[model samples]
Target: MSILKLGALRGQLEIKEFLRQRESVVFTLAFPVILLFIFGSVFKNTIAPGVTFSQYFVAGMVASGLVNTGFQQLAIAIPMSRDLGTLKRLRGTPMSPISYFIGKAIVVTASMLFQVALLLGFGALLFGLHLPTSGILWLRFTWLILLGSACSTVLGIAFSSVPKSGRGASAVVSPIVIVLQFLSGVFFVFSDLPKWMQDIAALFPLKWLTQGMRSVFLPSDFAMKEAAHSWELGKTALILVIWLIIGTLLSIRTFKWSEE
Candidate 1:
């Protein structure tokens, strides 16, 4: 069979496995929604003149959902597979290592997309979140989601190189995701964060992804709440692209097919 065909098959199996892990899948997708209801309900008042906290938070929740599927899941699964001899066994098969990671990435992207849809649908249905009305805005949102997913997935595989065993994956990756979420304005308003904290968070992809998503869903006038008092679309795309390149390079350099 062609490598592409083999990779596609592997990705299909990955999706099946994801479905089998019903509890994990449910938690991964539902955590953001739960937070949306909790925080969005408590901060029901407007964060800006016309935008309620729920409306303002929809983008961040979407970003968080992508991160959970892209980074957290891969970070745990990849290292666990390595320590469990799954990777070593696969290495002995006809499948190339690239095919393995490709399968992993495809599954991550698909899962993230499902999560994104859920968040947006729930937000619009229950929280009065306004989706992008213009075709151009939707186009912007599409490319941003694709770029953000690729960057986050690659970063996750790169990060998996840090943990030597499945047992340690959470220890190595959880703090990073948690810190990024907090600092990237996932649970708070970016404009309200300290300048130094904003500067630090700006160095990561989550902040830019969240900001890019906000630019798509929020009203144009809402740019006033952003750090630049604008959407910064160009900067957001550029930063995520740069991270994609960097993360791809890092994963190539560090990805392992077997425990080391």
Candidate 2:
């Protein structure tokens, strides 16, 4: 079969494997949903004149949630496959390596879409998320999700090299994701963060993703509260594009079919 078609099959298997692991399911998917409630409860007031903190925070969670499904999922999963010698065996198969990466992209994209749908549903039902009605806003939302998924998924595959073994995957990967979420304004207002934190967060794609999401879910005036005092849509798109390229290169350089 063609590599693309094989990749689709691999993606289905990946999703099934992910579902079977209750720990992975809870940590990578459910944890974000739980935090959405915890933070939403503590800061229930309006972030803007009309937008409640729950509403604003939902956008942030959506951004971070994508990171979870994309970055964190592959980061840990790939390493576990390596330590278990799964990748090594797969490498001996007739399947092309690119197909493996393609499978990963599919898994991230599918999981992220479901994740976002759940977040939006929860927000709308309980917190009144108020999704964008404008075509232009929805257009922006579409690209953000596309770019965000590609960026995070490839980066996660590259970052899978960090852990020494499957056992260490979560320990090494989780803290970094947590730190980025806090720094990238997922847990608080971007403008309200320390200047140093703001600058640091801008160095990564998560910050830009959060800002892009905010632009979609919040009013245009809410852009004033961003660190740039503007939505910076152009900048957000550029950063994610750059990172996607860097991540592709890094994954090629770092990818190993075996623990060896």
Candidate 3:
């Protein structure tokens, strides 16, 4: 079979396997909505004069959902596969590692996109969130989500090397994800965060991901509430692209077929 077709088949299998794993599905898909319900209601008051807290919060939650599925899920799954000898067996097969990685990436991208849509729908139907009206904004949003998800997935694959066993995957990866979530303004305003914390967050993709989504979904004037008082699209794109490149290289260099 052609490489393209092979990859698609592998990816389809991966997605199916992901769906069948009830624990993963629950954590990846349901956890974000729970966060939204708990925090969104508490912060139901408005951010700006016109923008309600739910409106402001949805963007960050969407970004968080992307990372949750794209990064957290993959990080754990990859290591668990390694511990289970799945990666070792795959390596012995005719299928190349590239195809397997591509399959994993496809699964992450699909899950994250679905998660983002559900969050947006909930925000819109229940909280009255407004989506971008302009086609250009939608285009930008599409590419940003694609790039952000890709970067996060690649980072997850790379970080999988850090955890030695399936049991330790959550312990190793969850703290980093949770810390980034808090620091990236996922639950709070970026500008209101301390200056040092803001600086640290700028070095990571989650902050930019949240900010980029905010640029798409929130009012343009809400940019004033951002750290630099603007969307900084160029910076956001550049940072994510850089991470993607670095992550791809790292994952390739460090990847192992087995736990030996």
Candidate 4:
């Protein structure tokens, strides 16, 4: 079969397997939503005119949810698959490696999109969050999701090589995600963070992703309040695209079909 068709078939299989993982479904997917309620309620001060901390936190969580779905999910899944010999078996089959990635992409994209919808729904219901007021902002939001998804997926694939065994996958990957979330302003205001923390997070894509996402949900008036004192969306896109290239290269170089 053609690579595209084969990839679609693999994606279907992946969805079925993911559905069967009750813990992954309940916790992996639900953790962010849980955080939304806990953190959103505590930080109720205003960030901008008519924008509350709960609303800001909700917006940042959408970006964080994307990272969880695309990066954290794939990074853990691929390493486990390698240790379990799934990729080893695929190597002997006629399936192109690209097909496997296509399958993973379908999974993360679907999961992240659902996550965005869920977060936005709850954000509106509880925090009075609203969608972008202009078509241009909506356009920006759409691209950020797309570019962010692509960047996160490739980075996840590359990072999968870090954990030596399936048993240690979560142990190794969890801290990285947690730290990035904190430093990248997903859980706090970027400008309010220590200057050193802001500098460190600025070196990574999550910080820019959070900023881009925040700009989408919040008003332009608030851009002046950002660490950069402006959205710097052009910088965000540049950083994400750069990481996408770097991640693709790293995955190609380090990706292994088996533990060997």
| TM-score winner | 3
lDDT of 4 by residue, 188-254 (tens): 8778899999999988888988899889998788999998889999999999999999988998898
TM-score of each: 0.97, 0.97, 0.98, 0.97
TM-score for predicted model 1 compared with the true structure = 0.97
Give stretches of model 2 more than 4 Å off. Answer: none
The CA-based lDDT of model 1 is what? 0.87
lDDT of 2 by residue, 1-260 (tens): 99999999999998898779888766766676787778777888886799888887899999998799989989988998898888999999999988899999998998888889888887888777888999999999999999999999999999998888889999999999999999998888888899999999999999999989999999889887777789999989999999999999999998877775
lDDT string, candidate 1, 41-94, tens digits = 888888787788788788998888778898888998889988989888998888
For model 1, which pairs clash?
A: none
Q: What is the Cα-based lDDT of residue 57 in candidate 2?
A: 87
lDDT of 3 by residue, 1-260 (tens): 76677888899999999899888788788788878777777887887878887887899998888788888988888899899898999999899778888898899888888888888888888887998999988998999989988998899899989898989999989999999999998888778899999999999999999999999998888898888989999999999999999999999999878988
What's the lDDT for residue 11 in model 3?
95
| Per-model CA lDDT versus the true structure | 0.87, 0.89, 0.89, 0.87
In candidate 1, stretches whose alpha carbon ends up further than 4 angstroms from where it belongs are: none
